[model samples]
Target: MPKVVLVGERELRDLVPLDRAALDAVRGAFLALASGRVIMPPILSMAMPEVHGEVDVKTAFVPGLDGFAVKISPGFFDNPARGLPSVNGLMVVLSATTGLVEAVFLDNGWLTDVRTAAAGAVAADALARPDARIATVFGAGTQARLQMQALALVRDLDEIRVWARDSVKAAACAADIEAATGVRTRAVGEPRAAVSGADIVVTTTPSSAPILFAGWLAPGQHVTAMGSDADTKCELDPAILARADRLVVDSLAQSRRLGELRAGVAAGAIAADAAVDELGSVLAGTAPGRPGPDAVTVCDLTGTGAQDTAIAALARARADAAGAGLATDL
Candidate 1:
């Protein structure tokens, strides 16, 4: 018999702690990804006027791990019009031994948000400069807030600047983060201003055009672009990519199809052999990171299935440890 567990967003919030353990899981998954132990297909999605969404699948048979997960996330754009967020979804966890579902976590996308942010943190821990301090974030959405939080785990941030088209939203997010982290958080007027002097700059926008230009980056800076998870979306100037001393991605295949690399390739700014390294390779010590203090590094993260699998496993473990979920025999 298989047991299914349903955990709502609030319960899940209490169950899973996005701390070092969660990040270690995600990092292990990425190492597996580089070693070809994980199966991650290209994400697929469809959109209508009222509803728009994407379905991403990741299955990892991590040597000592028990379960794998398939997450179906959908976004109804009209929900925000009704005073709700545009995205909602759940995850299905399966036993690795029997391939039978062990649990279904109706986490309502909160777990996904945390895990993804932690992935950025993992990338930063491995690729971002050791002295990274000044930070810039380009979105005021939930993910943007989490990005700031996650980066703090890896970098001793000194100053933080936020930018959003909506001045009010950016101001509110800045104030909230400043109060929470005690970092000098302020809302800036331009994207350029947010990025200038920043040792690490993160872009979380949904823009088709470049939000970050090469002219804004200084030597030894690290840029993490988390916005281009779709074929039509890009958040970095191809010119900036050309200037990068090292270009790394979470997945080579995913980066080609949907990450900032896709945009750089289209613009004739990056060649097929242009990638300096993959984060997994760097983490696994197969490649070097931070070759020099003057090197410019860029990490393109098109969220991977490995991350989903890692987080799902963490969520299930937390649920079991806390005895927090309803197990329905099916």
Candidate 2:
């Protein structure tokens, strides 16, 4: 008899906290992708330009894992106008031994959020300066808050700066961050001002135009750009890649095809095959991270299927240990 477990959003959230366990799982996933024979296919993206939305399907299999995750993620930018959440999704966990459905997680993109935040931690751990004291987040949104927490795990962040187009939102984000992290936070007025003099910067906006520039970056700065996951999206100026002493991407192929690297290369700002480092390689110690305290580093993360599969497996384990999900036959 085949069996399947249905894990709902609340249960997954309760089971998985945005803490060290999640970060370790994501970090391990990166290392596996670097060393293991993990098979990950290209992301299948379907765009709805008229509706201003897109859906992407991602899946991957790690050789030794007992199961894998296939996920469907959708984003509708205009949903807020209709009083709806912009992002929603689900994941399917399948057993590797029998190729049977093991569990279905109605996470609504929560797992994606956690994994992506964890990737930021991995990047900061690899590239950010050891004495890093402050971080600047380029958008006041869900990711903006998460990035602050994730970065703190790796760096000694003492303060945070929040920037958004709307001043009210920016202030609110800063206040919330201060309350949650017990770290001093400020609402900066300008994008360039937010970038200046900060040890670390994280761009989390879903912008079609550039909001960060090379000129704003000082020596010894590290920037993590996680927003540009689609061809039409860009957050950093193309020239920023040229200013970096080290450029690491979550995946070379994905970044070249869809992320900020596409914008940089298409504009002739960076080489098409520039000795781009992969985050996984850096994590696995096959490649070097930031060379010194004065080196400028950039990490572009275009969320990977390996992350989804890893997080799904983690969620399944947690739910099973807690006896939380509803189980049924397939």
The candidate that achieves the highest TM-score relative to the unseen native structure: 2
Task: Identify the runs in model 1 with alpha carbons over 4 angstroms from their true place.
Answer: 49-61
Q: Ten consecutive residues with minimal summed lDDT in candidate 2?
A: 148-157
Measured against the true structure, the TM-scores of the candidates, in listed sequence, are 0.95, 0.97
Weakest 10 consecutive residues, lDDT, candidate 1? Answer: 49-58
lDDT string, candidate 2, 1-330, tens digits: 677899889988899878888988898888888985888999999889999998999999987778999999999989999998899899999898888888999998999999999999889988899899989998899889888887777777788999999999999999988877778999999888888889999999989899999888899999999999988889989999998899999988999998999999999999898889889899988999999999999999999999999888889889989988888874
**For model 2, what is the error of residue 143's alpha carbon versus the real structure, in angstroms, after optimal superposition?**
0.6
How many residue pairs in model 1 have overlapping backbones? 0
Q: Cα lDDT of all candidates, in order? A: 0.83, 0.90
For candidate 1, write residues 1-330 as lDDT tens digits.
Answer: 756787778988787756777788889888887787677766766666444545444444555578888887777766787997777788888888888888888888888888888888888888777988888899898878888888887889999999999999999989877876678999999888787888888888889999889998898888889889888999999998889888889888888888888889999998966745677888998878777888888899988877888888898888988888788885
RMSD of each: 1.6, 1.3
After best superposition, candidate 2 residue 97: deviation in angstroms? 1.8
